[model samples]
Target chain A: SAVISQKPSRDICQRGTSLTIQCQVDSQVTMMFWYRQQPGQSLTLIATANQGSEATYESGFVIDKFPISRPNLTFSTLTVSNLSPEDSSIYLCSVGRRGLQETQYFGPGTRLLVL
Target chain B: SQQGEEDPQALSIQEGENATMNCSYKTSINNLQWYRQNSGRGLVHLILIRSNEREKHSGRLRVTLDTSKKSSSLLITASRAADTASYFCATEWKSSGDKLTFGTGTRLAVRP
Candidate 1:
């Protein structure tokens, strides 16, 4: 199992502003992912943060809107740019560990509210 | 697109009673995992059942998988108030990448 942590446990942001959420893992990981959970909804995968390369975003999500950076195996960041009220949700980061079997561990999550 | 859908979007049960949640998926999966999320918190992995496994147990939590039915069920025995949270079933599709797709989740409220 991996231990993951995210910065800014909760934040209130103004519309049109941006916020960058950070994720750190206790151990080296092979893959890191960003997710968004809307109120009373399931999680939506935002992107797969790739180390030493660009992030692979899912459909309906774009890089210009949610730029991601993975500088190393244990650290990554996701920035929500030009925030709106619709962006208010819980942003979580997860790490995928490869061993005998693959298991993904999630961070505490960052709660962002845009007004 | 969501790969899994859980029944009973919300459930209320008394403490000490058992609670069951069902999840149905659209595609063939290599494995399925159950996770619990408290209000305003991250998800905690409960158990993982592989395609080869039929039933698995972890403490009071039991998970049953049926590949033919393309569905899974999670049963919690002797539930406590702390069990009041949202439970989600995630699937790792065989045709897709290793990334897990999560369902809408079932909110369980165990009243004490």
Candidate 2:
């Protein structure tokens, strides 16, 4: 299992401001994903951070709002642009094992609050 | 819409008793996994059962998959107060992307 960490564990930002969450893994991983969890809700996949390529976002989410960058195998970042009250949620970073059957490991998470 | 739906949204069980949660998915999946989240934190993967595997056990946790019914169940034996948290079942479809589709989750409260 890979040990993952996210920077700035949490932050409170003003509406219209932006914050970038960083994810770092102990070992190089093949897949890294970003997820969002609303208050009292389950996780929803935001995008798959692809190394050296553009991130593949899920439906209803756009890159303009959440831009992702995966420059290397061990690190990735998700920037929430033009934050709003609705964007106030826990953003988590998880890494998957390399194979057809996936075993994912998650970081603590970055709690974002837009006030 | 969530690909998976769990029943008994909230469960209250006493310590030392067994806790059971059921999950039903809407699509065919390659594998089903169970995860635990405490206080809305990141998910901790408990166990995973492939479509062909009927059951899987990891320590006090047992997971069963019924592909015919498109459902799965997670049972925690000898529950403890520390087991009080939200449990979720996520699905990886056979023909879908790499993302694991998550369910609504069941909030379990184990009282001492």
Candidate 3:
């Protein structure tokens, strides 16, 4: 099992500003994933961050909007740019084991409210 | 869409009663997983059942998958207030690489 933590557990930002959410894992992981959960909705995969390479984003999401940085094996950051009321959601980070079917360990998540 | 759909969007039941939720996907999957989220926080993975497997159980939770129908069911027995949370079913499809597409989710409220 891996222990995960995120910074700025909850934040309220201006509509046009940007907020960077950091995710840290206790152990070095090969892959880390970012997710968004809007109010009264299920989790949506935003992107997958891997060290030494660019992140792979899902459909309806792009790097320009949600830029990701994976500086090392245990750390990654996701920036929500040009925030808006519709971007008010819980951003979560998770670390998965080697196999695709392995269970993923998730961080508490950063609650972002764009005003 | 590629995402799956879960039935009983909201469920309210007594603490001792059982709660059952169903999920239906559109494509063939290599595996299906169940996760629980408290309030709006991060998700906690509960169980994973492979395509070849029919059923899996952990603690008071039981999951059954039917590939013929592309659907799965989660059953929680003797529930408690702590069990009140949103349950989601995620699938790893054979075509999609490495990411799990989540279902609509079911909000279960266990009354004490």
Candidate 4:
């Protein structure tokens, strides 16, 4: 099992500003994923952060809006740019441990409220 | 698009009663997992059932998978008030790189 931690557990930011959320894993992982959950909604996959490569974003999400950086196997960052009230959601980081049959462990989450 | 969708959007039951939630997916998957979230906190993985497996049990939790129907069910027996929360089923499709697609989730309320 891998232990995951996220920074800025909760933050309230002004509209048009940017906030970067960090994810740290206790062990090296092959892949880390970013997700978003709006109020009263399910989790949406934002992107897959791969070490030493550009992140692969899902449909309806882009790097320009949610830029992701994975400098190493155990660390990654996701930046929500040009925030708006609609962007007020909980952002979560998850990691998949190797040989675990693809069970992903998640961070506590970063609650962002764009005012 | 979301790969999984859970049924009975909300369920309220008395403590010690059983709670059952169902999830249906649109595509084939390598594995399906169940997770629990307490309010606004992160999700805690409860169990994972591979495509080849039909049923699995963990403590008071029982998960069953029907690959042909592309559906799964999670049953929690003798529930407590603390078990009240949102439960989600995630599918790890073969196409997507190990990333999970979560369902809307079922809100279960276990009243004492």
RMSD of 3: 1.0
Q: Write the per-residue lDDT of candidate 3 for residues B31-108, one digit (tens) a residue.
A: 999999998987889999999999999999999999999999999999999999999999989887668899999999
Interface RMSD of each: 1.9, 1.4, 1.3, 1.6
Q: Weakest 10 consecutive residues, lDDT, candidate 3 chain B?
A: B92-101
Per-residue lDDT for A13-94 in model 4, tens only? 9999999999999999987999999999999999999899999998999889999999999999999999999999999999
Q: Residue pairs in steric clash, candidate 2?
A: none
Q: After superposition, how far is residue A82 of candidate 1 from its true place, in Å?
A: 0.6
**Candidate 2 local lDDT, A51-92, one digit each (tens):** 999999999899999999999999999999999999999999
C-alpha lDDT of candidate 4 relative to the true structure? 0.93
Alpha carbon deviation, residue A37, candidate 3 (Å): 0.8
| Sort order, DockQ high to low | 3, 2, 4, 1
* Candidate 3 local Cα displacement, residue A23, angstroms: 0.5
- Relative to the true structure, candidate 2 reaches a TM of 0.98
